[model samples]
Target: MREFMVELTTAVPEGTDPAEVDRRRAAEAVRAGELAEQGRLFRLWRPVGEVRSVGIWRADDESDLRSNVLGSLPLWPWMTAAVTPLQPHPNDPGPTG
Candidate 1:
């Protein structure tokens, strides 16, 4: 498997309905949890006061991560994502103890 750091910048159009934005955000959170349970998403964080987010992801390859993971994001249409592949570190904790 490969690990990647994905940075996301959200862009909710100014005229979009607030209720729809809220709905999409809530749905996005639910989908994120599902990805976590599937082992595709490892960690997620939001930058302080920024319209951006970061997530650590695992997949067989970049294509898999893009198609199966990123592609399935609920808020994908309103977000721009940059992905960087990560290398395993010797001192890093393994998947399990």
Candidate 2:
């Protein structure tokens, strides 16, 4: 598996119904939990005062990350994401250190 750092930002379309946005948010939370349980989603965070999020994700490859993971996001249509693959450093101390 490969790890990726994903940065995402969401925008609620102007003039959209607030209730509908709320509903989407609820669904997003549910999907997030499911992904976490499946071990695809490693960690998530929100940038303070910004409509942005960061996630550490594990996937078999970039295609899986794009299709099964990002594509499956409920709010994907309204979001923009940047993905960066991570590689381990040889000299860094690991858990055993």
- Per-candidate TM-scores read 0.87, 0.89
Candidate 1 lDDT, 1-97, residue by residue in tens: 8999999898998899999999999999899999999999999998898879998999999999888899898888888989999998999888773
Give the per-residue lDDT digits (tens) of candidate 2, residues 19-84. 999998999999999999999998999988877999999899989998989889889899888999
Q: Model 2: which residue pairs collide?
A: none
Instruction: Tell me how many clashing residue pairs each candidate has.
Output: 0, 0
- Segments in model 1 whose C-alpha atoms lie over 4 Å from true places: 91-97
Model 2 segments more than 4 A misplaced:
95-97
RMSD of each: 2.0, 2.0
Poorest lDDT segment (10 consecutive residues) of candidate 1:
88-97
